[model samples]
Target chain A: MSTLGLIFRELRHHKANAALVVLALAGTVALLVAVRILATAAERETRRVTRDLGFNLRILPRDVDPDQFLADGHSDKTLPADAVTRLAAAAGTFVSFNHLTPSLERRIQLGGRDAILDGLGPSVVGPGEKKQPMGFNIPSGKAYIGHALAQRLDARPGATIDVKGKALAVERVLVESGTDDDIRLYTSLADAQSILGLPGRISEIRAIDCLCMTGEQDALAQLRNALERSLPEARVLQIRAIADARARQRQTAEKYTAFAVPLVLIVGAAWVGILAALNVRERRPEIGLWRALGNGSVRIASLVLGRAVILGVAGAAMGYFVGTQLALQAGPRIFPVTAAGIVADPSLAWWALLIAPGFAAVASFLPAMLAVAHDPAETLRAD
Target chain B: MVSCDHLVRTFAARAGTVAALDDVSFRVERGEFVAIHGASGSGKSTLLLTLGGMLRPTSGAVSIDGRDLYSLSAGARTRFRASTIGFVFQLFHLVPYLDVRQNILAGVPRPDADARARVDRLIEELGLGPRAESLPSTLSAGERQRVALARALAKQPPLILADEPTGNLDPVNAGVVFRRLADYQRAGGTVLVVTHGNDAAPYATRTLRLDHGRLAARLTTEVL
Candidate 1:
């Protein structure tokens, strides 16, 4: 028999004890992997929600009510087209700017039903304006509708539909925002104005205030100062609640991720360490017998350490598989992602697989030492 | 050939240090089956352990084939024990996890074809052919001791050291163990065994008796 075969024989002799060690190790690795994935998923979900909120700060006329903007649809405080244009110029590389001029009441008839048809002008984004989920870069004679509206009208991209006596091609369908975005249809500024017979008029100019994960603290202050200096007619609306909530959301996500990973590692190491020590204790006599049978201290140590290697690696591999399944099923359910939005973050997974066995090995170090420390003369002499 | 020159082994207790082998000495030639007889606690096991390099002597030295055993490093001494000396215990130190064949094979670090043949022959000679694949737990006292003896001879070492080899066996099984040791002596190998009584006296070419860890003078038994 081979040297490795000797270790296997010992395992078979103490099958229940070996299984206990393996199970404890597997649980440790599985929990560690799950915690890491949850942390990553939390951060990713925060970013996705922040992007879906469209714009953080909106530049509306001074008369616009802070609390009633959603109900008024920015139509209660109208701004001229040139005023919107110069405000974009004044912002100058500091923001992503878009102008909106709704259809009078901002609700129109489409496919024989009343729907929100907002006249959205093209957005002016800086060279480094990371993402523009709601930029609304509309062109003439084409339109984008929300997922609910498309479903109601059975409309798809590239199909033409009659809108107020004019044929417009369906450009794209937006994902469900779970808000009024579901009932809204955004048409080009020129098309909406001509159709409403109110050319060169806009309800409001919207500005996404920051370039970072959030735009609440210094970015919001800078925007207030910029607008006060240049476009005094428009006061930067803080959008009240979203401004504060976004910053708090991001901070909580990052902190949770940081705190959870280390905690998982500590728990996993503890489980493996205790169980490995017990496993060594259970095999003390076997170790002594091997020593008495003309095997040296080094060979005895190899037998113990070899068992640790197998348990560590085997437990880690099994944990990776089980943990991935758990993460996949739980991630989308937690984030409410309808599609397969599980970003596995392969780098993190690779680290888990690499570190799990390392936990097992390091945990077994003291136990392996204890195994070789037995007095063969006394131990073998015992019944 | 083996020689022990004034070997002294001491153990310390809370009260004082006591010598297990008090200035003891002996010499044995090749192919000599010598039995060292003593009562319990006569330090017969200590003498065998010191000679086998399993225990270190506090003073003096043991040399096998002109090489000083105590002069070598700890690692070298272990290797010397594994490659040159074979050991059998009163309790029959057979690995319970392994079958008789594997227990025999366990003595050889890496058993090649010749080593494997040596183990097979020892198993057959010990009358353990049918029980080669059986675990030691299932074997009788005689069979277990025979397996232990086979394991000791697995490497075909130049010397065999058996401490109370038949101490745990019945009279019939004790006779079985002595006959095997006698046969090994006839094959031109040195054998040194420790026993509490005359169970192995008929098989030994000479007997060295010990009392209170000291060799008794005029203690020799010549078998014609």
Candidate 2:
């Protein structure tokens, strides 16, 4: 018989034992894989949402008169034209700036229908900003409307909509940024400032981005200090990294695995060992005769271990099947949806299935060791 | 081809160290059929174990082919045992879960073609072909013993150690087993049998009688 054939024969001898071990290992691997996917997808979704909203740090004059804009039915909070230059000089890097005011309740005419307009814009952004989920840039007299807001205003691209008495044509529809994208609009900073009638006053300087060291606490401290020194009047904030978000979710997943994996491994080991012990006890004379017949300690040990490997392998295979079924069934709901669509990675679950059985074999080793360490002669001679 | 000098075996039980075999020594040459006749606790099995390299001698040397067994490392000794010796038990300790053929093959190092062919030939010669696919539980006491012999012979070892190889056999199967051992000897294999039965003593070239932890006599068949 081939080595595997012999092992298979031995494993088949104890059906119940093999099943238990495989189930334990499969369950552990499945749990680990699922949690990993969950954590990863959550991180991805968080970053997607954050990036879609634009501007990790939003800065404005610390005190802005809200009543001035409200009473006059229009307001502009435009900063000085040199504000971007100043921030660029202070940060030692050129920084892009966008001017925006949150949408105020007001009326707009879409076609012949009057509807409440909810749009804010006239923001300048860096190169990559336009591609973000909820970001857009337009020239004067044009606007990008949210899907929900556009539907409410009966507005489509190329259609004119009145925003606070200033008429602008819709340039595009902002699709799928969840609820936030549905309620906002996009316009050029100049147009927003002009419409709001506050040409010299900017509402808030929307700070684009500055990449920095994530792991080095001292570097982060220095960077924070630098931002403070550079934009002293504007509060500086650090945006969370995609890596940090992923790591946090992964940490939560790892915590679950740390507690659960050992339990599964120990249970798998014990199950194989207990069954093997019983098998050995039942075949005491046979084991003895093997030793007496010149089967060395290693051979006897192999015979015992071979049996456990068989069981472990069988169990791992079974568990893998069960786990994959679970992952496929549950994976979609956890990720929910992405900007593109629902996110799922089936290969990760399959990888878990393939890796679990090897672990099962390892778990069986301890039990195999205990069962093979017997005195052949004495065991054989006993009734 | 085998010798033991002043061998001692002790086991520490809950009650303390008990001497199972004390200062025992004997030898068997190639092609010799030797029977170690002893009553219970007379150390016949212990002597067999020490010779087989399964049990280490506590106080003396046991050698095969002029090489001291204890002098070899643990792994080497195991290889030595696998290559040089085969074992048969009176109780027919076949692995019951495996089919007869598989149990027979299990005696060999692994599932080599030669081992399988040897086992197949042994099965046919021993009239076990009809039962080869069956488990041990399906075989009679005599058939089980025959299967056990087939397993032992599968390795084609130079030495055959039988711990009461015919103990569970009836008179008819006992005669068959004894004749088989004689045939093995005729083929130039050494046979050392530990037994309580004196009925097979005439078939032995020499009888080493064990009584109360010592070899009482090395009697030839004529003398017996």
Candidate 3:
């Protein structure tokens, strides 16, 4: 009989034992694969969530003192009306810039108290536009009154507010934006610019760099540098904290995977090692029988090690397949927004496929060596 | 032919090291059936294993066909045993998953075109033809022994070793096993067997008795 035939028949004789080892190894691999997919999906979702929060860069006319800008929360500094248009031509796919020019504040009697109003004008940032500048844009002659101003004026949507002798309908009472938005009146950009007597100009340029850090480049930092260079006459304030949050979250996920991947494999190896050791002990008589049948130590060792390798390969493949399905099912359930479908991460898949079997081989190595150490005379003589 | 010169084997016990074979020496020529009788722990099984080079002697040497058995490496000794020796045990030691035919076929170092025919003839001659396809677990004690004997003869080795080949068998089966060993000796094959009972003495051309790991010098006798 061929050696392969003998090995195969031996497996059949102890099918249950072989199956037990494979099952344990497969479970370990499956868990690792699932976690890998989860980590990838979470990192991707972090980026998207970070992007949707809003732009971290503000471009206002240069040479404005930070103290003055903070005290008034208004700037007479203006960027060219065609600045965005001109920049668009030179911008790569990464740029997402927009324009907004708040009207000069006006005083009028509202609920017996002097209230100030400003119009969102020049070119209103639209709702459907990709380069969104904060809230949705209002139509011509329409206004979004701040929550505090509306309370003070005893006004709501569809009410008229006259400022600087121009009457504009209140389109909607703005929710308390908690920042400068609570006390401001917003109108179309063109109306704001016209009312401020600045034709074809803007107070500030609001833009999202669409800047994501990746293998291509440190796009976020690069975007900041590009903006400072191209619009040197404009003050570029880089938004922080949120971008830092995204980066930190991504780092945490990577670290967790780094620690977890090895932990799972070590556990897998341990479980398989225990099983292999026990199997070797149980098969001592058979090993002695083979030795007495004139098989050498190397051949005897091969009988045990060969089976371990085969089981390792088989278990790895099965675990990878099962893990993919589990990740797909569990990910969506755990985090509906972030956990996407199966990520075809070739490296992770390769790692799972390669390492699982390698662990099995290592797990079985001691037992295989021990199998060879048995003296055929002593083992058979015991009977 | 096989020769041993003052062979000694010791194993470490929990108390201390104890010798299993003490200055034992013997030789067996071709075409001889030699039976060894001893009480349990008298080292009859150890003697068989040492002669086959499965166990290394603590002292002295064993030579087969003029080549020092222990002088060869482990791998070479294994190959030598496979090519030159066959073994039968009391428990049959047939692989539980294999059928009788496969068990018999396993003894050959490598099967050739005539291997199947040889195996078939052995099974038929041993009256195991009807049960050849049956697994070892399903065979009767007598049937199992016959399969083991056939396996030993499958490779056509010049020397055969049997350790208590009939220890677990009934008298009828024991007689049959001895007869098979006798037949191989008559056909110019060397056979060395160890049995607890004297029933196998009639089948051997010579008998040697061991006591306390030492051969009883004056007890060696030629069977008449």
Best by DockQ: 3
Output the lDDT of residue A71, model 2. Answer: 57
> Candidate 3, residues B1-224: lDDT per residue as tens digits?
98999999988999999888999889889898888888888888888888988889999899998889999998888999999999998778887878999988888878787988999999998999999999988999999999999999988999999999999899999888889889989999999998777777888888888777788752445432
Model 3 alpha-carbon miss at residue A183, Å: 6.4
Query: Residue-wise lDDT of candidate 1 within B20-78, one digit each (tens)?
Result: 78888889999999898888888887788788776788998999988899998877877
lDDT of 3 at A254: 78
Q: What is the interface RMSD of each candidate, in Å?
A: 2.7, 2.5, 1.6
lDDT leader: 3
Off by over 4 Å in 3: A56-176, A181-240, A339-355, B218-224
In model 3, residue pairs whose N, Cα or C atoms come closer than 3 Å (at least 3 residues apart or on different chains), thus clashing, are A56-A239, A120-A187, A120-A188, A120-A189, A121-A188, A121-A189, A121-A190, A122-A189, A122-A190
> Would you estimate the TM-scores of all the predictions?
0.71, 0.73, 0.78
**Candidate 1 chain B: minimum summed lDDT over ten consecutive residues — where?**
B215-224
In terms of docking quality, model 2 is acceptable
- lDDT (Cα, tens digit) per residue for candidate 2, span A1-383: 45466556655765565565556555665555545555555555655554554555545443445576445332234355445456554534333222222222233444455433333443433444553423454677888887778877778889997776888888897785675556566676666656656554445555544332334443334444555666665443334454344335445555665776567656655654565566667666667666555456666667666655554455545555555556456756655564233334567545654555555445545545655666777666521
- Candidate-wise lDDT, in order: 0.76, 0.66, 0.77
Query: How would the docking of model 1 be graded?
Result: acceptable
> If both were scored by DockQ, which would come out higher, candidate 2 or candidate 3?
3
Candidate number with the higher DockQ (1 or 2): 2
